[model samples]
Target chain A: MIIIISFFSFILEYLFNYLLKKTLFLPLITLTTTVIVRPFFKKNNNLFYMFCFILGFLYDLIYTGNFFLSAGIYLIIGIIINLISTNMPNNIFTSIFKIICAVIIYRTLCFLFFYINGITIFSISNLFKSIYSSLLLNIIYGTLIYLILYLLSKKFNIKRID
Target chain B: MHKKEKNKRTIIILSSIILSIIIATIFIKKNFNIPSYGIKDGMMYVNNIITRIFGNKDYYKLEKENEKLKEELEQYKDYKSLNEELNNEILKLKETLSIEELISDREYAFGTVINRNFDYWQEKLIINIGKNKEIENNMAVISNGNLIGITDDVSINSSSVILLSNHKFPLNISVKIKIDDNYIYGILNNYNETTGTYEIIGVVDNIDIPQGSKVYTSGLSSTFPSGILIGNVEDVTTDNFDLSKVINVKSETNFDDISYVTVVKKGNK
Candidate 1:
């Protein structure tokens, strides 16, 4: 199920960024990470971390050109997911909150990394714009992916943590 | 007591891992770029096939329209010939004055934009041609016959281009504003994302320079070839000290709509 989601996310990312050229309208890549958050607690946490490492590594390989930078960033995000969603009950409202937090965390980490490396100039306005520009699209994508996974889990009798 | 201790340990371990990764990011070589060329190109190939099958259904109609436009454009041949004669006269005068710069042959490799990286620094484009097509770093990239960006990282079959609109990098290219029978050179430095224009700084004070003057590469900088159309000046202003002029240019090339690019390399003079 995770692999399928990742594959579709990859294709959709290409569609949005390349064919449609609507990257400003939709951030399907980052929001798709939310799918694995629920499965993290139900399974072995180490395996989940490894999955994120591979996903991030692949992301860097295909897109960013950096080596393990995204891998590490994704690992950190995985930890964040575990930390935030560990105690919260699984519901639509909580899912929205988690998605919002994840987008902020992802953008902040990326901005900080780029700013520190002198790859991007630091500006409070740009940071807020970056965060806000992606928020609406990512929230919709996150909720859709979450609901799809939820339905699939129910149909397949997959064990999910409350 | 035991559960709390376990959670604390887990947090410590995760934090340690994150710290180590951050340290690695700092120490790692910035140019240690290993892009997955085959995988990306393969995906693009598939995408192209899919797009061809499902997209552009009116290809024949567009071709017919293009042919009709070419026929209609034949009436302008006299004007074109007159312009060519004037250009030849200017070249002859320049040669007689011994101020003519050596012009080199330019070779262009056409490629499709496979990816647009809209990540944090959203100014990169991945093209399908790279070292295989003799694409090198700093080679000028253009779309629709207008300057767009320069090649940055070249892999086996793909290369990344850093667009002129990139504000993160202080990549200054020498440019000249073409006025009536005169040219004023300046440095194309900054890009204003909000205004969708480029800021040309270090321009000499020219009070009579009108808006909509054509800007082109000066070829003073070795990175780009001369005479490539950059844009037209939209507005001009003086520095706070009123020493040098700052020109704002609006490029005809739509950065967002870039799908095809031609990478140009200058040959020997």
Candidate 2:
């Protein structure tokens, strides 16, 4: 199920990028979907971690030139989200917040990766402009996804594993 | 005791994962020739199908117009005279040098763009032809006779091109501007994000480089052949700190609308 969700999310991302060329913000649907599905498999934490790593590896192989950077970042993020989600209440607002936080963290990591690779965009204003645009779109898209997931869970009566 | 054991196991797992990531990164960096042929082929196949189903109709009309214009330009009588004059000057220089001159033959492979990188900041595009078509790294990629980019990573059926507008490791091209009877040389580097143009730096302050003068690749590097049209000088400003001149170049290629490109493969001279 996680793999299927990630695959579809990747396709959606490709379509969005292909159609909307100039849009600064890109919603990371795959990572967000993985975070949303984590609660359903809380007991099997190792399997979840493995799934995150594999999904991230595949993403890197297809999209990026770097091999392990995405995989490592995703694994760490999955762990962080797993820890937070276990303590926090699973609701629409909190879920949306979590997705926003995840997107910020991912973008920050990407910025750091760019810096390390010596592709530093010198102006702080420019950096913030790109980040804020992307953040705004990610939040909007994330809210919609969260609402859909909330409705589906409620209708299907899916219980949390913990 | 149960909680303590679980915490210990969690810490061990986290540490191991970090260690594995470090090792993997190092390994991949050292052995960089991992050909992602299967993934690229799958992506190209899917993209081709999608584009065919929902392709832009206007691109075809533009391509036809571009071809027509090129044919018309080639038939101009003034262009023939200019070509003859340039060839005569080259022959005179060769005689003066008293050395054997060998012209490197270039092979062009035409390809269609398959995909573009997802990141907005990264200036990269994937083309359909790759190692299968003898396309290798550092080959010059031109669109409609204007320089666009250079091929970087190649798979079996696809190759990724790094554009000149890429902020990362700004591609340094040696360029020159002809002024009356002399040519002034400078290095083109560091794209100006605000102005959306490339700046030619390190030009001597004394040279009178005119606005609207053309910039061509000096062929200092083997990757790109000399005489390829890069851009035109839009504005020139003197650096306040240093006495050098900074010339702003307006690129010839419209990056947004590039559909087809010709990859030039020059034989060893």
Candidate 3:
């Protein structure tokens, strides 16, 4: 039931932004509508949840030592992002902003949660730097993912299943 | 469609995807790894020789190295016995050891440096030594304070060296902190270019090692002559930073200046 969750090493900057209450003014994630549903089952209402769930699933798979943290975070983020974007049409830029915001938002929540829980030894400065670095890295990753989706759209003739 | 029907559809899809992902996690965890692609070991050197013949100045430097090695070969063969005695004493003290057993039996073979994979992804220096030269897998490869790496793949006249700078590479090294009397053991992992993170890992465990220290190979792993220069310590972040300390080792041998290299026949040449 995650709304958004993502990983990036430059999370420190984002943390700084949050502590300063500075709005990023830039999103760091890229969203991808499902290719399978967009192509065949044009009315695949559950597609958003599926994609979000899989995103978290992949995050978990990539970093196994963290246990289920990535997967849990991914699922939560997926649900949240998809729900928030429910009314918005799947325009490429809109999806991009939503994904980017999702990453920062999730990371912010994690830092606050960890800080409140007294589990982390991070100062606001370190946490902010971590967020910033993670965000920068996530932007690169998010861009590449978006490019692949663009290629998929062109090659496979897929579109938003609306 | 009815609201109830839509909610059910969403629930079913999310559950199924999440469930499948959970199941797939087992497979992905075990199998979903990045495929390693590179210029396979041996052809690289032969290619270098050809590239040199056509007036590549890089080849000339290697020609110079070959001449130097030829001279060292004669001297190395002469003092194998006295070197063996020093090898024995050191081996006795090292437990959880690698090179000690190697030196005790005096088992080693000679190999020559052929080419270095000086690319960004892999910093490995490929050598023209293999099982034929008694070079086995994981044998430490060093040339002066410059630790090249350990042997990986071996053919008749060739073996792949996993360089110290390789992301996939890990060396069990001991740190010589200027401030502390004790030596700490840590694994040196390569720098992640995208993240700009270098790990001198394992210090986050039991050892209370701090930043600004020096890291060296614990000749205990193999015959690396223990106190050879390793690297300078950087900020000591959490163990979550990586398996190693985020060490920034400014290597004595500038990567570009590495032309001549000597492969230590640790036990006996």
- RMSD of each candidate? 4.5, 4.7, 13.5
Two-way lDDT contest, 1 vs 2, winner = 1
Select the stronger candidate by TM-score from 2 and 3. Answer: 2
User: Ten-residue segment with the worst summed lDDT in candidate 3 chain A?
Assistant: A30-39
iRMSD of all candidate structures: 3.6, 3.6, 15.4
- The fraction of correct interface contacts reproduced by each prediction comes to 0.32, 0.19, 0.01
Clashes of 3: 36
Writing each residue's lDDT as its tens digit, candidate 1 over A35-138 gives 44556347466667667777877877666666666677777777777776677777767777877776777678777877777666777787787788677776
lDDT of 2 by residue, A1-162 (tens): 455667777876666555555456665767777777777675778778888887777777776656666777788788888888878877766776777777767667766655654545545565565556566666676667666666776788866643
Model 3 chain B: weakest 10-residue lDDT segment is: B31-40
DockQ for every prediction shown:
0.37, 0.29, 0.04
Per-residue lDDT of candidate 2, residues B30-146 (tens digit): 635365568767877667766776677568887999999888987877789997898788768878998554333367889987666444354678788998899999888898787
User: B49 in model 1: Cα distance from truth in Å?
Assistant: 4.7
Q: Which stretches of candidate 1 lie over 4 Å from their true place?
A: A22-24, A34-37, A40-43, B1-29, B35-43, B46-50, B53-101, B120-122, B168-170, B205-207, B240-243
Task: Tell me, by DockQ, which candidate is best.
Answer: 1
Runs in model 3 lying further than 4 Å from the true structure? A1-43, A63-67, A109-120, A134-162, B1-85, B88-269
lDDT of each: 0.74, 0.72, 0.49
Question: Candidate 3 lDDT, tens digit per residue, B178-232?
Answer: 4377776666666544344346655554565566566666656554656555656
lDDT of 2 at B188: 83
Mark the regions of model 2 whose C-alpha exceeds 4 Å error after superposition. A136-162, B20-35, B57-105, B112-123, B143-145, B167-171, B180-183, B201-207, B237-245, B254-260, B267-269
